[model samples]
Target chain A: AQSVTQLDSHVSVSEGTPVLLRCNYSSSYSPSLFWYVQHPNKGLQLLLKYTSAATLVKGINGFEAEFKKSETSFHLTKPSAHMSDAAEYFCVVSAFGGNRDDKIIFGKGTRLHILP
Target chain B: GAGVSQSPRYKVAKRGQDVALRCDPISGHVSLFWYQQALGQGPEFLTYFQNEAQLDKSGLPSDRFFAERPEGSVSTLKIQRTQQEDSAVYLCASSSPREWGQPQHFGDGTRLSIL
Candidate 1:
């Protein structure tokens, strides 16, 4: 079984302030973790993915996430939040092995709101 | 040609009516997937196809849902007799040819409303 949890349902940040969206995962095998952002009525855009690569993975738009295995966490962070960063974010987990039944699991999501 | 595309951006169907959602994956991408996303909820996997092969459909809620990728390019997800509970955003995604750790490219999705 594989699952992910977004610790916060909604997060509010002021533009130019730091932002943090926490996520945790549960999996039986080594997993691939990802962060994705979706604007209103838009498809999911990949932010970053951790596939046993560098623990701290940087993504586009000044966003990054650190994969902490000991804590079973993959938390997305932005040094400075922008108005455009206000959107819903999802944490996802995929299996590392090629199991015929492997399925990716998504977190409930955290909606970010930015204030100028 | 640039990204995955889905048809019927929005559909409103009466209860018990059938609906079909179309998805066109990136050309030559072998892995395609369908998902259901309820309001404020994360998208849930419904099915996956590798080429024309329907490799996984266990996540589908019931037999009311059926999916086909006839020629390994375009796919359709048909809902037989939709219920109010069937209202959700149907998302389609495609990744490269691989079994694991492939980042999927997603479509804008088709919003279905069962009234």
Candidate 2:
């Protein structure tokens, strides 16, 4: 079974400080990993994705994640936290190939808080 | 181009009532997905449709949950005998090719409340 675990349920960062949200995944095969953000009353927005091509992936709003196969981790990071960055973040993983029906497993989610 | 759109932005149903939520995928998107997102939780897959074919529905919690994409462009999810636990935001997303690593565009989602 493929599953994603977000290490923190909540993370608080001061504005302009660096931010890190950790995630680990379990998959039978090489997996496709993604990070998504959701604002209040808004839809989930794709941040970045890792598809075996590159270990380091950069995404919108200065967010990035590194795919570490040995560690079974794909952690999202940002150089500085913005007030608008306060939102719910999710780590998701899906199998590389086979069936289109294969569902993407998601982490519970991490709520980011930015303090000024 | 417009993004995915879900209608009945909000729906409130009583127990035993049947409710239908609709989704309009982006133009030319070949794959559409429906997910159930409970309050304070990540979206859980419910079903997938490739064009007009309903490929997978293993994530559906019960038979009471039914989804259809008859025309391949618009999809509808119907829940019969709504339960209190079913109250949550139902999200709709669509992707271009239905392949791994393809980015999915999402709609705001319909907030369903079961009484």
Candidate 3:
């Protein structure tokens, strides 16, 4: 079974400070990892994805995540926090090899709060 | 270009009533998916479609839940005999294919309330 675990349910940070949302995944096969952000009453937006091509993946809105196979982690990070960055972040994992029906498992999500 | 779109941004239905949710995937998208998201939780896969074929419905909660993509472009998810537990945000997503690294584009989602 493929699954993702988000370490923090909620994180609060001050503007201009660095941000980190930890995520760990479990999969029997090589996995594809992704980070998505959702604002209140809005659908999820892709932030970044790792497909084994690169370990450090950059995404929209100055966000990025590093895929660490040894650690079984794909933690999202940003150099500095912004008020606009306050939203719920989800870490997702999917199997690389399977039918098109392969399921994507999502983490519980981490709510980010930015204090100005 | 427009992204994946879902109709009826909000739906309120009485228990035992039936409702249908629609989704319009991006042009030329080969894969479509439906997910249910409860309050304070991540989206859970409900079904998947590859073109016009209903490839997977493993995540659907019960037989009352049915999904179809007859044209391969537009899909509908129907729920019968709605229960209070059925209340949640239904999300629709589409991707070009199941190829590794492909990101699924999601719609704003339909917030369903069972009264």
Native-contact fraction for each model?
0.88, 0.72, 0.85
Steric clashes per prediction: 0, 0, 0
Tens digits of per-residue lDDT, candidate 1, B1-115, equal: 5999999999999999999999999998999999999999999999999999999999899999999999999999999989999999999999988845779999999999999
Better of 1 and 2 by DockQ: 1
Pairs in clash, predicted candidate 2: none
Off by over 4 Å in 3: A99-101
Residue A52 C-alpha lDDT in model 1: 90
Report the TM-score of chain B alone for all candidates.
Answer: 0.97, 0.97, 0.97
After TM-score superposition, what is the CA distance of residue A16 in candidate 2 from its true location, in Å?
0.7
TM-score of chain A taken by itself, candidate 1? 0.96
Candidate 1 CAPRI grade: high
Candidate 1 yields a Cα-based lDDT of 0.94
Candidate 1 stretches with Cα past 4 Å from truth are: A98-102
Compare the candidates by DockQ and give the number of the best one.
3
Better of 2 and 3 by lDDT: 3
lDDT of 1 by residue, A33-104 (tens): 999999999999999999897999999999999999999999999999999999999999997654643479
Each predicted complex: what DockQ? Answer: 0.86, 0.80, 0.88
Judge candidate 3 at residue A9 and give its lDDT. Answer: 99
lDDT of 2 by residue, A16-57 (tens): 999999999998878899999999988999999998898999
